[model samples]
Target: MRTRDTRSVARAMPWFLLVAVVLFALNLRGPIVAIAPVIGQIRDDLGLSAATAGLLTSLPVLCFALATPLAAALIARAGPERAVLISLAGILVGTLIRAQGGFAVAVIGTLVIGIAITVGNVVVPVVVRRDFPASRVGIVTGVYTATLNVGAMLTSLCTAPLAEWLGWRAAITAWAVLLVAAIIIWGQAAGWRRSVLGERVTAPDSSEAPPAHSASYRSLTAWLLMLAFGGQAFSYYGITTWLPTILHEVQGLDDKSAGASSSVFQVLAVVGALGVPVLANRWRPGSVVGLVGTLWLAMPLGLLLAPELWPLWSVVGGAAQGGGITIVFIIIVRMSTSNDQARGMSAFVQGGGYLLASTGPSIVGAVHEASGGWTAPLIVVTASVLVLLIFGITASARVESRHP
Candidate 1:
C-alpha cells in the first residue's frame, strides 16, 4: 500500500514541475518585452536618440552573451532551484530600479535584469532535465519554449495600453508582479519537494557520450551555422524592437494600436514553434529551413513593397522568426556526431549569435535615423534574412541525424 501511494506521488510531481516552469516562463520574456511597446514614450521623455532607445532592447541581449559564464557559475554554486529564486529577486530589484526613470538608472536596471535572466536561461534546462524522465523531457522543453512566446505576446499586446493608463515608467515596472508570483509558487514547489525536483542526475547512456575524437568545432559548416544563427537572431531582435515604432511612424497609428497590431507577430510564434518540428518530421530538415527562411524574407520584402500589408508581413515574420530559431538548433544537433560536439556547437552558435544580436536594434535604428525612412531599415532586415538563408540553408543540408 505504501509503495502504491509513493508511485502515485511520483506520477503527480511532473505536472507540478511543469506548472512551476510555466509560471517561470511568463516572467522571462515579458519583462524584457515590456519595454518594446513603450519605447517611443521612453525616448521622448528621456530625450534619447533612436540608437539610445534601441539600447533598451539590445542591452539585455548583450548581457545574455557577455554574462553567460557568470550565469553558469551562479547556477553551479547555487543549484538550479536556489539560483532561480535568486534570479527572481534580482529581476524584482531591477524592475523597481528601472521604474525610477532616468537614463543611467534605466541602463543599470536593464543590465541587472539581463544578468538575472541569463541565470534563468542557463538553469531552467537543468531543472527540466533533472526533474523529468527522458520521455517527458521533450514535452517539458517544448512547453518552456512555447510559453516564452506567450510571455512575449502578452507584454507586446498589453504594455502600450498599460503605459497609457499608468504612464510608461509604472507600466514597465508593473511586470515585477510576475516575478513575485513566480517566486512564491516556485519557492513552495522547491521547498516542499526539494528531493524530487533535485533528484540524482541520470547517468548518460554510453552511446550518447562524446567520443575522444570529437571534431565538430573544427568544421567549417559549424562556423557557417553560427553565422546563420547570428543572422536569425539579428533579424528577430531588430524587428521585435522596432516594429511598433515603424507602424506608428509610417501608418500613423497610435502607440496602443501599433503595439496591439505588433502582438500578432509575437502571438503567431506559438504556431511556428510547434509547427517546425512537425513539418521537419515530414520534410527534409534543409527543406524546412528553406521554406521558413523564405517566409522570413517575405516579411521585410512585404513591408518594403507594400506597407499596406503590414499585418500579413507581421504574421509571416512572427512565425518565421520562431521557426528560424528552432530550426537552427535542430540543425546544430543534427550536424553533431555526439552529445559533446552538439553541446559545444550550441554554445558556440548561441554565444556568437547573441553578440551579433546585441547590435541589431542599434544598427537598424541608426539606419532609420540616417535615411529618415523605413526603407533603409527594412532593407537591412531583408539582408539579414538573406544571411540566414545562405548560411542556414547550407548548414541545414549537412544534417546527418535521422530525425530533426
Candidate 2:
C-alpha cells in the first residue's frame, strides 16, 4: 500500500494558511489606526474634548488587555476556525456601528473591535505554530508582523479622506467591509479541515512545540518583558495620539501637514515591525533586544529635545520602537516550549503589559494639561522609555515560564 505523503499535505496547507493569516492580520490594527486619521472630525462633530479623543484612541488597547486572555479559553470552547470567524464578524459589526456616528456608539463599536482584534492577536501565533509546524516559527511570525504593518499603514493613510469624502461615519464604518471580505475567504478555507486535527478543542501543547525555557513571572526577565512590552505600548499610543497635534502646534505645520507627518511615523513602524523579528532570529537574543531597547530610549528623547530634527529622528525612532515590539512578540514564541504556553504567556504579558500601556497616553495628556506645553509630557515619555530599557534588558536574559 502507498503511504500518505505528509510533506505534500504540509506544503499545500502553508500557502492557503498564509493567505488566511494575512487576511486575519489585515483586520488586526484597522480599528486603532483608523481612529487617529479622522479623530478630529469625530471630535468636532461630537464636541468631545482633546482628552476624550485621546481616550477614544487608546481605549482599544485597554480593551485588548481585558479581552486577550479570553481568547485561549474561547478558542478552546469554540474551536480556532469558528473563534476567528466570529471574532472577524465582531470586528466588522463594530466598524459598521462606529460609522453610524454618535460618540457613544463609536466608542462602543471600537470596544467591540478591540475585543475582536485581541482574539485575532492571541490566535494567530497558535495557528501559525499549528499550521506550519515544519517552518521556522520566527519566519512565520515575521510574515504575520509584516502583514499587520501593511494593514495598519493602509488604514492610517486611507482613513482621513475617506471620512471627509464619504462622511467620517461612513469612512470609519467602511473598514467593516474589509472584515467581511476576510470572513468570507476564511470560511471557504474551513472546509480543508481534514488536513489537521480538526481544531482540537484545547490550546496547542506549547511544552514540546517551540524552543523550551523556564518561566517565572517573578523572575527579573519576566518582569522586564512585561515592563518592556507595556512601556512600548504606552509610548507608542502616546506618540500616535499626540504627534500630529504636537507637530501642528509646536512646529507650525498646518493641519494637513501635521497629519501627513504623523502618518510617516506609522509608515516607518511598518519597516521596523517587518525588520526586527527577522534580525532577532538571526542574532544573539541579548544583543538584538539591547539594540532595539536603545532605540526605544532614544526616540522619545529625540522628539523632546530636538523638535527641528523630527522628520529624520521620528522616522528612525519610530521604526526602532516598532521593531522592538515585533521582537517582543517573537521572543514570546521562541521562549515557550509549546503553543499553549506561548498563548498563555502572551496573555499574561500583554494583559499586564497593556494595563501598563493604558497609562501612557492618559498620563501624557494630563501632563500636557498641567504644563500647557509638550515639555512635561515629553519628559514623562522619556522617563517611561528609560523604564522600558531597564525592563527590556532584564527580560532579554534567560527566563522562566509562568505556566507548566
Candidate 3:
C-alpha cells in the first residue's frame, strides 16, 4: 500500500510541474505587452516625447541583457525554484511601482520588471531540459512558448478595453495578482521548505554534473546562436513596439482597431510557437530558418507597399517572428549536454541577444522621427531580417557545441 501510494504521487508530479511552468510562462509577458496597446495614452498622460516613449519600451530589454548573467549565480545559490520565487517578488514590486503613474517611476519599475523576467528567461530552459526527456524537449518548449504568446495576446487585446473600464493604472496593477497566484502555486508544488533549505535538486540522471567552464562561450556555434536569437528579438520588439502606432497613423485604423490588430499578431504567434517545433522534427530545421526569414522580411515590405493588407502582413510576420524565437531556444537547449550547460548557454543567448535587441525600438523610433514616416523604419526592419537570415542559417546547421 505504501509503495503504491508513492508511485501514484510520483506519477502525478510531472503533470503538476507542467501546469506550474505553463502558468509561470503566462505571467512572463503580460505586464510588458500590456503597455504597448495603451502607449499613446501613457505618452499623453505623462507628457512624454517620442524618444522617451520608445525608451520606455526598450528599457526592459536592456535590463534583460544586463541582468541575465547574474541569473545562473542566483540559481546556483538558491536553486531554480527559489530563484523563480524571487523573480515573482521582483515582478510584484515592479508592477506596483509602475502603477504609480509618473514617467520616472514607470521607467524604474520597468527596469525592475525586466531584471525579474530575465531570471526566468535564463532558468526556465534549464528546468525544461532537466525535467523532461530529450525527445520531448521540442514539444515541451512549444507548450511554454505557446503559453507565453497567449499571455501576450490576451494582455494586448484586453489592455485598451480594461483601461476604458477601469483606467490604465488599475489595468496594469491587475496583472500583479497573477504574480501572487504564481508564487502560491510554485511554492505549493515545489515545496517552499525544501527550496529555502538550499537542498540541491538533481536531475533524474545525476551523473551529468555542471560544467566547470562553459565552452559554449568560446565556440563559434554559440555566437551564431546569439546572433540568430538577437535578430528575432530585434524584429519582434521593433514590430511589437511600433505596430499599433503604425496602424493608427500610417494605415488609418482607429486606436481600438489598431490594438485589436496587434492582438491578431500575437494570436497567430501562438499558432507559430506551437506548430513550428513539430515541423522542425520532420524537416531539416536549418532550411526552415530561410523560410521564416523570408516571412519576416515580407512584413516590412508588405506594410510599405500595401498598408491596406495589414491583416495579412501581420499574420505572416507574427508566425515568422514567433516561430523564429522558439526555434532559437530549442537550438540552445539541444546544443547543451546537460542542464548546467543549458543554463549557461541560455544566459549568453538572452544576455547578448537582448543587449543587441535593446536598440531596435529606439533606433526605429529615431529613424521614424528623422525620416518623418514609417518607410525608413520598415526598411531598417527589412535589413535586420536579412542579418537574421544569415546568422540563423549558420546557427541551425546542427553543429556540435564545444561545451556539449
Candidate 4:
C-alpha cells in the first residue's frame, strides 16, 4: 500500500513477486488441466464422440489463443495492471459458470476462463521484468515456473476426489476460489510496482520520434522466439489434455491411477520447469534451447512406447520438457533489448504459442479417432516435438528486434 521505496520492501520484492508468481502460476493450469482427468466421465455422461469430447476439453485453450491479441491490445492501451485484474475477474466468473454444468455451458465457461488465463500469461512477465533486476530474473522465473507446475499438479490430482465427493461441477469450480485469493494479495502489492522495474519511455526529440513500432511482428528474432515458445506450449498443453486419458485407455490403468499418473507427470514437471533454467541460464540460450527441443522429441516417444514405465520416465521427461518451457520464457527476457521490446515479445510468443497450442489436444484426439489407438497420437506428439526443436534451435540465439 505504501508508495515510498524502502530497503525492506525492496528486498521483499523478490519474495513478494515470488509469491505473486506462484499465485499467478496456480491460476493458470487449474482450469484447463482439471478438464483432462475427467474427460472420460464427462463423455460417458454426455455421450460425446471423440471429436466432440476433444473440442469440449480443448475449447478453453482455443479461447486462450483467441484472447491473447486482445489482451496485448488492452495492455498496450491500459497498462498490465488493469488488464490482469480484469482477467482474474473473468476467470472467477467463468469458473462459476462452469460450475452450473451441462456440456454446452461448461465448454463456454471454460473458453471464457481460458481467455482470462491469456491475460495473466501475457502480463506476469511484464510485471516480473518491471519489478525485478536483471540478476534475479532467472531465479524468479524458475520459482514462478515451479509454482505454475504446482498448480498444474494440484489441478490434475484434485479433480477426481473433489468430483467424487461433490460432483464434477464443484471440482471444476474450486480453482475459482484461488483467483479470488490472488486479487487480495495483488492489491497489497500494487504500490510496489514502480519500485520493482524500470520502463524505457523516451521522450521524442521532436513532436513525433517515429512511433515506437509500426508493426511489432516484423522481426525475425521475435518470430523465432514465438515459434520456440509455441513449440514448448504445444507439447505441454497437448500432454496435459491427453495424458490421463491416454494412460487409462492405452496402458490399462484405472481412472484413479491414471489421474494420479497425470498428476505425477505435472509434479515432476515442476522440477523441469524450475531446475532446467538454473542450468540453461549459464549457457548460450540458443544452444540450450536446441537441447530442449531434443528432449521434447525423445521423452514423448518414451511415454508412448513404454506406458508402464512412463510414471518414472515421465519424471525425467516431464522435467526436461518443463525446463525447456522455462527456457522459452528466459529467452523472451534475454532476447529483448528494452521493456517495450520485452512486452511486445511476450505478446507475440504467447499469442502465437497459445494459438499453436490450442490445436494440440484436439488434433491428438482426432488422430486417435483415425488411427484407432494411441500409436498414431504418439507419432503426432513426436512430430510436434520435432517441430519445436527446429524452432528452438533458431530462437536460442542472442537476438533482439530492431522494431517493436
Candidate 5:
C-alpha cells in the first residue's frame, strides 16, 4: 500500500508542477502591462512629464536587467523554490506599496516588483529544464509563454474597465490577489520543496553531462542569445508601453478603443507564443526567426503607412513579438548543456538584454516629444526588429551547431 501510494504520488507530481508554473507565469506580466493602458491617467494625476512617464515603464525593465544575475546566486543559496517564494513576497510588498496612491510610492513599488520579477525571469527556464524531458522543452515553453501573455492580455483588456469601476489604485492592487493565490498553491504543491533542495530531483532524459559553471557566460552562443533577447525586449516593451497612446494620438482612436486595441495585440500574442514553439520544433528556429522578424517590421510600417488598418497591424505585431520572445527562451534552454548552464545563460540573456531594452520606452518617448510625432519613434522599433532578425539568425545557428 505504501509503495502504491508513492507511485501514484509520483505520477501526479508533473501536473502539480505544471499548475505551479502556469500560476507563476500568470503573475509575470499582468502587473506591468496593467499600467500601460492607464498610463495617461497616471501621468495626468501625477503631473509627470512624458519622459518621467516613460521611466515608469522602463524602470522595472531596468531592474530586470540589473537584478537578474542575483537570481542565480539566490537560487544557489536558497534553492529555486525558496528563491521563488521570496520573489513572491517582494511582489506582494510592491503591489501593496503601489496601491497606496502616490507617484513616488508607485515608482518605488514598481522598482521592488521589478527586482522580484527578475528572479522568476532567470529561474523559470531552469526549472523547466530540470523538471521536464528534453523533447518536451518547446511545448512546455510554449505553454508558459502563452500563459504569460494571457495575463498581459487580461490586464490590457480589463485595466480600463477595472479602473473605471474600482479606480486605478484598486485595479492595480487587484493583481496582488493572483500573486497571493500563487503563493498559497505553491506552498502546498507536492515535491516542490524537495526539488528545490536538490534531493530526489528527477534527472532530464538527455545524456549530456552537466556544463562547467563558467561555460555559458564565456561562450559566443551566450552572447548571441543575449543580443537576440535584448532586441526582442526592446521592441516588445517599447510597443507595449506606447501602443495605446499611439493609437489614441495618431490613429484617432478614443482612449477606451486604444486600450482595447492594445489588448488585441496581447491576445494575438498568446496565439504566436503557443504556435511558434510547435513550429520551431518541426522547422529550424533560424528560418522561423527571419519570418518573425519580417512580421515585427510589418507592424510599425503598417502603422506608419496605413493607420486605417491598425487592427490588422496590431495583431500581426503582437503575434510576431510574442513568438520572438518564446523562441529566444527556447533557444536559451536548448543551447545549454545542463540546468545550471541554462540558469547562467538565462541570467546573462535577460540581464544584458533587458539593460539594453531599458532604453526603448524612454527613447521612444523622448523621440516622440522632440519630433512631435509617432513616426520617428516607430522607426526606432523597426530598427529593433531588424536587429532581432540579425541576432536571431546567429543564435539559431549557434543552437543548431551545438545541439546537432
Candidate 6:
C-alpha cells in the first residue's frame, strides 16, 4: 500500500483531473456571460422591458445565493464527482430549454443554470481540496478560477456576433458545446477512477469535524470569512460593471477605447488568479492577504486621485480581484478538515458573499445617482477593500493556526 505522502504525490498532478477541471471551468461561466453580449437582442425580440430582460442575467446571480443551501445538501449526498456530472447536465438541459424561446422558458432555463452553477461553485473547491495535495491546492484552484474567467471572456467576446448571425436563441445555446465537452470528459474520468482506484465514492465523514466549523453558519470564523468573501464579490461586480463608464466619462475616451481599457481589468485577472498560487507557495497566507488587499485598495484609490491612470488601476485591480477570490477559496479549503466541513463552510461563505454581490451593482448605481459623481461610489468601494483586508487577514490567521 502506498503511504500517505506517496499517495498525495501520485494524485497531485494527474493529467486527466487537470483536463477535467479545465473543461469544467470552461463551461461554468460561459452560459451566464453569453446573455450579457446579446441582452438587447433578447429584449427587443421578446418585447420585454429592460428590467424583465435583465432577469435572464440577474436571476442567475440571485439563484447562486438563494439556492446555495440546497447545493450544499446535494454535495453532501451525491459526492463531489457525481455532483459535478449533475451540474453539467443541469447546465446542458437548461441551455437547451433556454433556447426553446419564450420569455417564460428563458427565465426558467436561466434559473436552472444559475442553481446548477451554484452547485459547481460549492463543489469544485471541495474537489480540488480532495484530489490535490496541500502544496498544489492553491495552483489548481487558481487554474480553476482563471479558466472561469476565460469562459466568460470567450463567450462575451464571441456571443454578440454569433447572436447577429444565428439569432439570440441559437447563439445563446451555442455555448452548450462547452457543457457537452465537460460532461463527457468528466464522465470518463469518473469511470476511469472507479476502475483504477476501486473507490467507493461516498459522502465525506464529518463525525470528527471540530465544532467551530461543523455547523459552519454558526461559526464565527465562517461569518468573518463570509464578510471577506463578500467584500471581494462586492468590489469585483461594482468595478466590472462601472469601470468602462468611469474611464469614458473621466478620461474622455470613446466608448470603444473605454471598453478596451476596462478589459485590462478582466484580462489581468487571469494573471492575478494564476499568480496567487505562486505567492501562496512562498508567503504566509496572511502576507498573501495583505498583498492582494493593497492591490485591491490601490485600484479604487488610484482611480479617485489619478483618473488619468485608469489603465494602471484597472490592471492592478484586476489582478487583485482574481487573487482575492483565489486566496479566499484557499483559506476555505485549508480550514476544512473534511469534505463535509468544506461543503458547509463553502456554502456559508459563498452563499453570503453572492447575496451581497447581487446587490453590488444596484447599490453602487444608487450611490452614483445620489451623489452625482463617481467619487462617492469609489469611496464605497474603498470601504469594501478595508472590509476585505480586516476580515481576510482575520480568516487567514485562523487558516495558519488550523494547519500550522
Question: Could you tell me every candidate's TM-score relative to the true structure?
Answer: 0.81, 0.87, 0.89, 0.85, 0.90, 0.94
lDDT of 2 by residue, 1-404 (tens): 11356455545766777788888888998777888778788788899997787666678888878887687678656766887898898898888877676778878888888888888877776676566663366666767777777888889778888987898877877777778888887886676555443444244553544333334354455566788888788887777778888888888989888877676777777777777766765675566767776776676677777887778867877787677677777777666656556666676677778888877777898999999999889888777777667777666666422321
Please report, in order, the local distance difference test score of every candidate based on alpha carbons. 0.78, 0.74, 0.81, 0.73, 0.82, 0.87
Predicted structure 4, TM vs. truth: 0.85
Model 3: how large is the Cα RMSD against the reference?
Answer: 3.2
Name the 10 consecutive residues with the lowest summed lDDT in model 5: 196-205
RMSD of each: 3.9, 3.7, 3.2, 4.1, 3.0, 2.9
- Residues 217-244, model 4: lDDT tens digits: 8866667767766767777777866888
1-404 per-residue lDDT for model 1 (tens digits): 96686667667878877899999988888888888778889999999997787777778888877876677667656667788899888888988998796899999999999998877765665566556675554446556767889998788778889999999998988888888889998887786465443343233435556654344457767778878988998998889878988889888889878876667888877777778867766678678888889999989899888877889999988889888877776565455554345445555576677888888887998999999999999999999998999998777765544343
Count of clashing residue pairs in every prediction: 0, 9, 0, 5, 0, 0
Pairs with backbone N, CA or C atoms under 3 Å apart (clashes), candidate 1: none
lDDT tens digits, residue span 1-404, model 6: 55675466446437679899999998888898888888888888889998788788778888888999999999877888899999999999999999797999998899999999999999998888777788889999999999888888898899989988999899998888888989999998887666555544443354545555579877888998999999999999888888888888888899989888766888888998999999998998899999999999999999999999888898899999999999999888888888778888999999999999888878898999999999999999999888899999998887788788
Better of 2 and 4 by lDDT: 2
Clashes of 3: 0
lDDT of 5 by residue, 1-404 (tens): 96686667667766787888899999887878878767888888888887687666677778998998688788656767777788888888998897686788888999888889888888889888876777878888888989989987777778889899998788878888899999987786634445443345444425345564445677787888788888888998788778889999987899889877877887888878888888887888898898889998988899899988999999899899889989999888887776667778888888999998988877888999999999999999888888899989997997797678
TM-score of 2: 0.87
**Residue pairs with backbone atoms closer than 3 Å in model 3 (clashes):** none
Q: Whole-model lDDT, candidate 1?
A: 0.78
- Write down the lDDT that model 6 would get: 0.87
Model number with the top lDDT: 6
lDDT of 6 at 100: 94
lDDT of 6 at 183: 92
State the lDDT of candidate 3 residue by residue for 133-189, as single tens digits: 777788788888889999887777788898999888888888887889899998886
Please give me the total number of clashing residue pairs in predicted model 1: 0
